[model samples]
Target: MTQPWKPDRGIRHAVIALGTCGVALVAAGAVLDSLWLLGLGTWCLIIAIGMELIYRP
Candidate 1:
């Protein structure tokens, strides 16, 4: 039998915060035309979303 999955509240909050920051960074990068910031933001977004998907019940 397989065990059910559960996510911690703190981790979920952190993920949400990370995703928000990522979106902000993406916008800032677009405004400033910075490729580095854009790439970093995209990475953060991907990681956060991936984690959420993996932990989803």
Candidate 2:
């Protein structure tokens, strides 16, 4: 018999937190016109999306 998939809540929460931080950073970067912050935020967002997809339940 095959078992159903289960998500790791801790990882999920961390991913969410990362995504939120990425968004906040992106917004802050835009407001402050900071290229480095914007690049970092974009990188974080990409990693968050990759993690969510790879670790899906």
Candidate 3:
């Protein structure tokens, strides 16, 4: 039997959530003219990508 179709609860899930938030932050920054928000979002996305590359289950 198969269990589920979601990320395991922990590092991967957290990283994915961060990526999702990053997308939202980028959009909000664009609409609100906030450079800080854009930078934070970019960093979040970069971290997510790096984590995904390093983490393996």
Candidate 4:
């Protein structure tokens, strides 16, 4: 017997989360005085790239 192939829900969720987080980080950066939010955005972007690479066939 063989297992059925399935779509990657984890990657999909990760992409959505990354997008939302990125937007929030950018908005916080603009509204706040610290650079931490901007840095967080950069990190989120990096994580997005990594997720893309992992999800790609």
Residue-pair clashes per prediction, in order, are 0, 0, 0, 0
Candidate 2 yields a Cα-based lDDT of: 0.88
Instruction: Locate the minimum summed-lDDT window of 10 residues in model 4.
Output: 1-10
TM-score: model 4 vs. ground truth = 0.70
Which one wins by lDDT: 2 or 4? 2
Global fold similarity of model 2 (TM-score): 0.82
lDDT per residue for candidate 3 within 7-40, as digits (tens), equals 5558778888989999999999999999999999
Model 3: lDDT to the true structure:
0.86
Residues 1-57, model 4: lDDT tens digits: 855854776787888799789878978897896599988987897888788778865
Off by over 4 Å in 4: 1-5
What would the per-residue lDDT of candidate 2 be over residues 1-57, giving only the tens digit for each residue?
Answer: 854754577679879988998999999999999999999899889989988898874
Error (Å) of candidate 2 at residue 11 is: 1.4
Q: What is the C-alpha RMSD of each candidate to the true structure, in Å?
A: 5.3, 4.1, 3.0, 3.7
lDDT for position 18 in model 1: 86
The C-alpha lDDT values of all candidates are 0.88, 0.88, 0.86, 0.81
